[model samples]
Target: MGVSLRDVADLAGVSVKTVSNVVNGYAHVAPATRAKVEEALSRLDYRPNLSARNLRRGRTGVIALALPELDAPYFAELSRFVIDAAAEQRWLVVIEQTDGSLERERQILDGVRDHRVDGLILSPIAIGADELAARTDETALVLLGERIHDGPADHVAIDNVRAARDVTEHLIGLGRTRVAALGAQDSAVSGTAPLRLAGYREALAAHGLPETVVRVERYRRADGAAAMAGLLTGGDRPDAVFCFNDLLALGALRAILSRGLRVPEDIALAGLDDIEDGRYSTPTLTTVAPDKAELARIAVDLLRRRIDGRSGHAPQEVRAGYRLMARESTLGR
Candidate 1:
């Protein structure tokens, strides 16, 4: 017969309830008891039956992690971080991609009432206030990225406005004007897009420049290349471009190279979210770096607390400050 909780408890010389408490991380068990239980579990190779445990405790020990797209490097990295953090706490993560759709995000939220997961960690794209408010009551949901309604759920996110502004300022400091901001999805009602644009404008305004030179495009490399092409073909071309993301920046780089324009000499490019590829690309990207791993740690921590019915430990609006990484793309130094 396979080893069970009872076998583990017997080997550990502790009551089965004590072993259970240790397994569940109930926080009431003594250190010595926990050590004994852990040792016993290791010796017996005991793995708790998660389904049976869920049935007994009314908790799935699982969280729903929803993002816009897994294809994006930012979202993929974020998911990896979140999954790792959840694993540390003995919880499992179920990932879902909503594709930045309002209806799909609503559907995921509605699934909470059906007990699909013990809690939810959502990065919503086009959620309405009513929908956000409706979902907050029944489930433990922690909002990420854009600020949703501030009713019941906890929020862990970067200050997108400030981060974006700082990145813009870095480009400005490189002595480049006629700056262009790129990557604003069509039908994007979320504040993240505009907030980033606002930052770009603010940077321009600080330098006594106008903000009329912006090209809104979908959040894709192709969109970025097309937008850049249009700007170059037009009469007024920006000497510098601050893209919303690394992917867009990559596309911009492609467009610049295709047009036989020398980066940092003819035009400089910068972006946010310093992905791995950014570091390795020819004329390495200049961008704003977010503490991605830390963000994931905080998100997982918040979700776990909500599931445990604990409150008031919320880390209030962590900035996760951005670092302006100056690379050859902007100005070789």
Candidate 2:
């Protein structure tokens, strides 16, 4: 038979109720008592009976994480952090991909009839404020990313405009005047691109530099390659490039190398999101690194509070922190 709460309590010299309270994450438990209970749990390899616990609590102890693209390294890494944060609270995470489709996002917002999970953490790419405001589902929701600002949910994200400006300023500090931005998009679905572009423009304007933007349908390697190729063949070439994400920057690096032009010597480059690939690229990559672990922790904690009826009626908007990581891409190796 599996070890039960009674076994843990017996080993810890505490009442079963105390063990139960500690397991349930009650804040009132004394630190020493909690530590004792935790040690006992570990010693006995005690696993809580989630089915029985959920039956009593009227919750599934599960949360859904909806992301636009799991294939993207940034999103993939963020998902890992979210899963870790959820696991700390003894919660299970169900990952859902929206494919950056408005219809799919709307479906997720509208359809929560089953109450299969206690709450949801969504990184919306296509959904807007109107659709979010129209959501009728009572399921606790937390949002990630810049899409759907001032919506009816707890939100967590890094400051996109500020981060973008910081990256652009870093390139400018290196004495690159003609810096081109590679990830501008004409689509109304995503809010991230526009905010980033605004930051780049703001930085350039402050330095009295002319703006050069290349629009792409998507922020992919192919798009970056195509955009860089066009920029290279143009009448006036930029002295530097600021890609919206590391993938695009890496792609641009490929295009630069294909043209037999040296990085930093001929043109400096930078990007955001600081994905793993950036660290190992030929010229490396200078990028903005968001505190993804902290972001995930904050999002999960907010959702947990909402699920436990602890969060107040007023929605929360939390901004996570980020820093610029300079590497070989912009600075000489």
Candidate 3:
């Protein structure tokens, strides 16, 4: 008969479940709502049930890192950095792959996660901010990449538009005209593709150069190979290609070689996410090098702070540093 959760919920003008989310440090709850709940809890002197407090104290001490696809070299490389970073704090990591499916992402967000992990570092691909905002379940989440939603979660990402624009400018600096943007995601409104495409368009406008575009269902090596093949057979082929990622750039490199063309001599090539394979290819790739190690370090540190029970702090939005690596692939051997 003491102050129950229902009383706190009523006082905060939210549901009991929402009050629970606020107390449990869920990510999706609005700042105002969480603040109101905290104020109500203070006024009512609310304390969690003994059993709940004991359960929270018995944390598994592990955390989950979920990405769209681990098969992608960039993600695989990032996993390496994250694992190493987590080891610094003596915490284990659980990796989850969503296979680039919105349904799967929604399922993960549904709170069916392994209770052992204290929190999550998620890189959502198929879901956007609007869809995430509509969800009621809350998790301690730190989002990575260009977030589609503006939720109360920490975000770690690089400036995609600026990176892409710089790549395009590099191509322009190489005296290459008729540059085509390869690996565009078709039938999609969000993701790396849209932002990079925006940069490509921006660079074209700034330099007064016409843009060449090819749309694909997804960003993959196979997608890049196929798109490059089609462009080889079509009219007004490009002299340079700025792919959305390293996988696509490598795929296109193979296609160009098989078609009896030498890279840089025939078409300059560039990509993002300085994956290792791209560095040692026959003609090394030029790319926007996002500091993956720094990204992992910063994100893991943020998660650690939350794990240490730091509360009443606004979520942070951090941008990782990146530099354009002008390699032999684009600069000529």
Each candidate: what lDDT?
0.80, 0.89, 0.85
Sequence-dependent TM-score of model 2: 0.84
- State the lDDT of candidate 3 residue by residue for 1-333, as single tens digits: 477788999999999999989887899999999999999999999887744544857666677888988988889989999999999997789898998788888877775344656778888888877776676644567777764535567788898989999999999889998999997776554677888999999999998999899887777889889999999999888999999998889999999999999899899999999999988998999999999999999889888877677644777788899999998888743
Candidate 3 Cα lDDT to native: 0.85
Per-residue lDDT of candidate 1, residues 1-333 (tens digit): 577788998999988888888887899888888998999999888988877778888988889899989999889988999999999987889998998888888888887767768888888788865656655456777877765435346777777778778888887787776778887655666647777887887888889976644455456688778788888898877888889889888888899899999787888898888888899988899988888888888887877777787666543454455577889888832
Model 3 ranges off by over 4 Å: 1-58, 112-114, 310-313
List candidate 1 stretches off by more than 4 Å. 1-46, 149-152, 213-217, 313-316
lDDT of 2 by residue, 1-333 (tens): 689999999999999999999987989999999999999999999898877777787798889999888998999999999999999998999998888888888877666547678999999877777778777788999998674566788888899999999999999999888999999888756568989998999999999999999988777788888889999999999989999988888889999999999898899999999899999998888999999999999999999999887589888999999989999988843
Q: Point out the higher-scoring one by TM-score: 1 or 3.
A: 1
Models ranked on TM-score: 1, 2, 3
lDDT of 2: 0.89
Q: Where does model 2 exceed 4 Å of error?
A: 1-56
